[model samples]
Target: MVTFEYAPAPESRAVVDIKSSYGLFIGGEFTDPADGASFKSINPANEEVLADIAQAGVTDVDRAVAAARKAFSQTWSKMSGRDRGKYLFRIARIIQERARELAVLESIDNGKPIRESRDVDIPLVAAHFFYYAGWADKLEYAGYGVDPRPHGVAGQIIPWNFPMLMLAWKIAPALATGNTVVLKPAETTPLTALLFAEICQQADLPPGVVNILTGAGETGRLLVEHPDVDKVAFTGSTEVGKAIARSVAGTSKKATLELGGKAANIVFDDAPLDQAVEGIVNGIFFNQGHVCCAGSRLLVQESVYDDVLARLKRRLATLRVGDPLDKNTDVGAINSAEQLTRIRELSEVGEAEGAERWSPECVLPERGFWFAPTVFTGVSQAHRIAREEIFGPVLSVLTFRTPAEAVEKANNTPYGLSAGVWTDKGSRILWMSQQLRAGVVWANTFNKFDPTSPFGGYKESGYGREGGRHGLGAYLVPSERSGR
Candidate 1:
């Protein structure tokens, strides 16, 4: 048996005062759901029940939509974009001021490493708000049209992987474009969104401008299908995203989906092996491989296969896997029981399909959901590990002979979210970028994101862009840019 030390979670100073049953945030206040039912939010690290959050049913979704509609028509939509910019600026500053508290809450609720939450997640959340804040009053210069008007109300549903950051992605641009919003945080990671509701209160944003209703799949369905919601934005599994697309078919309600990906990181024989190794590690294992654009498939040139695999195994052995709150921990717990099951099942399929599996000889924590940093060798393009999005710390290695072969194998997926290339030749990098079909291509790097750059996907990875000027499209009315 492997013994591991488990530390108690730090106490929070922010008013965790919301009842075990948290109501919907409507009109600048936390109000009870119309049906008054609630669901439990669990801590995946130890499977403990954190709190019961209000489950918004169809009636509650209608009520939330009505509140958002009222704000849009009476107050928010009427406000000048410059004035709306002030509110976003305030929210950004508040996020910066309360960064520590939010980071802690996010890590506790989402099971991501605290070091990541404090450094990467929270900073990026603030950065996203700050980035979009500058654009609120600059919509005219954004090339959307002469007078870009807000799309009355937006209904957004974000996943559990990056709670606070996703909230910022959904809320910031919507607010920047002068739209009111009713956003749904993933059922498991509702705390940060609820905390954000308090942040909005501190910023004194107008009532009904932003409302949060926390619940499971049914609640999400209600939000997406509600007749009054002007637009719907979702980030999750591709299956769910396609369902939403079909649900919104023939309807004028605007929708954008940021779905799943099984990205490929290609390393050529001429590449710097050390740098490629680092990129591979950060690409697949960062955020415990919970990222949508995780480079789960690593395609390496056959000439350097043995050397690269040896180095990769050695590096993975040194990674710390333990308490999410620990600053030294490199890999954290799996997001949930369901996610772990899926990862294990796919990994088993990889083994049964005759691919060789490898793992570091390290012990994992006993309490939380855990998976060893895994790698599969001799993987063919048809292998499940190479095809499906494991969404865990599992890397599938496929050897290719030439640059053309690498690109062909890398682009052999329904997902086109992201791809990575590691080669010393600049021409090869440019060539691979053009051929890869993914939205974001990292040459000599992997998994790097910026607030100013646009990101989304092609094919089953879903549609539209999330950041930069492209993001403004989701919040603007069609007439604003449609005709002269």
Candidate 2:
């Protein structure tokens, strides 16, 4: 037997300077809230305190909304579309310039591997802004009619999984369409958003064009329910998405929600065994499986099920699970203790439901929340693990006899966020893509994202798209109005 040893290659934490405390960013300035309650955001990798974040109350939400409205009416709305494009272009350049620092800050606060933040998240954040910036001065040619109008003030609430990226998804399109925004980032990962406020300042963006409020669910609720807000955009749990839908019902507020998923990755016998195994791993284990569109369910053709499982187990053994700042680390810590608890509880239910659980022989850190990459075999549609979104480094494996069976099983879930199909047959890929009811379908690939592609979900996974030209519709109203 031979063993290989490796040295730790941790990135420098000094790249980002943490403030002792942060205030709400409203009207282009950071201000203390009337209600002084605050929360601390900690690094999930080691449970180290990162910074203190303000908790926004109803009064604070009101102030932020007022600022957004004022910016919309007095400054941003009056700005020329071509000049608006210039501001967005400046923001994109600033993000590119500070990309490394933002990547480090994102990894520390979000508990994702530095490689992902540096390579995938931060770069795409800049790309989203650049892509939308081009559309600011060309909305008439965007197929939305002669003169689409911007919604006044958008209230956007984002999740912690991909903080900076999600912020870009919401704010970029809203700004491109001439809408001012009040964005409330998730409480767990609010640091990068505050940093983004600083970036806005660096770009010399007009005051009140973007307001960031950091707080818990109540803060998000107050912002979403604010009557003065013209639009509400959210990316989180399906239950909360429903709550927002209800809150905005029978009102003038428009909403776009990107919610939960239990996407199925279907593998046929024709798929290259090694490549299929890699896709399975990448689909479920990326970001500690915190992704809403993660392929949590694996459906394999029965003819090659045993071979696929063997190869998958072998690949799982090589995955390094540890400090997120380590460049070589494959899987990082769970986002929070609460999310870790949810993952563990669901995994326990899987065991109790007669499914077999397996994990790699990897050691976890002592102090922080962690879960080894896990897979459940013999998972049936009736099992909780197979049906629900674990939202962690957990996967459920099920088998099917034919392509039709795979398609049926894949679409059985209430979530239609994303799905993956792996096979060499071109015709079969197209056929399966048509059968699966997911918003984003990957053929022979998994977990791929680009700024030009529109991404969202169907059914209970929530409504509306978040990327590409389609995203502009969420912030614009049709030029021709129907009589009420």
Top TM-score prediction, candidate number = 2
lDDT of 2 at 386: 87
lDDT of 1 by residue, 261-293 (tens): 999999999999999999999999999999999
Instruction: Give me the runs in candidate 2 sitting further than 4 Å from their true place.
Output: 481-484
Off by over 4 Å in 1: 1-19, 478-484
* Residue range 1-484, candidate 2, lDDT tens digits: 9988678999998989989999999999999988798999999999999888999998999999999999999999889889999999999999999999999999999899999999999999999999999999998876677888899999999999999999999999999999999999999999999999999999999999999999999999999889899999999999999999999999989999999999999999999889989999999999999999998999999999999999999999999999999999999989999999999999999999999999999999998889999999989999999888889999999999988899899999999999999999999999998999999999998999988899999999999999998999999886773110
Whole-model lDDT values for every prediction: 0.88, 0.94
Clashing pairs in 1: 27-208
lDDT measured at residue 54 in model 1 versus the true structure, 0 to 100: 84
CA displacement after TM-score superposition, residue 376 of candidate 1 (Å): 0.5
- Quality of model 1 by C-alpha lDDT: 0.88
Which pairs clash (backbone N, Cα, C closer than 3 Å) in model 2? none
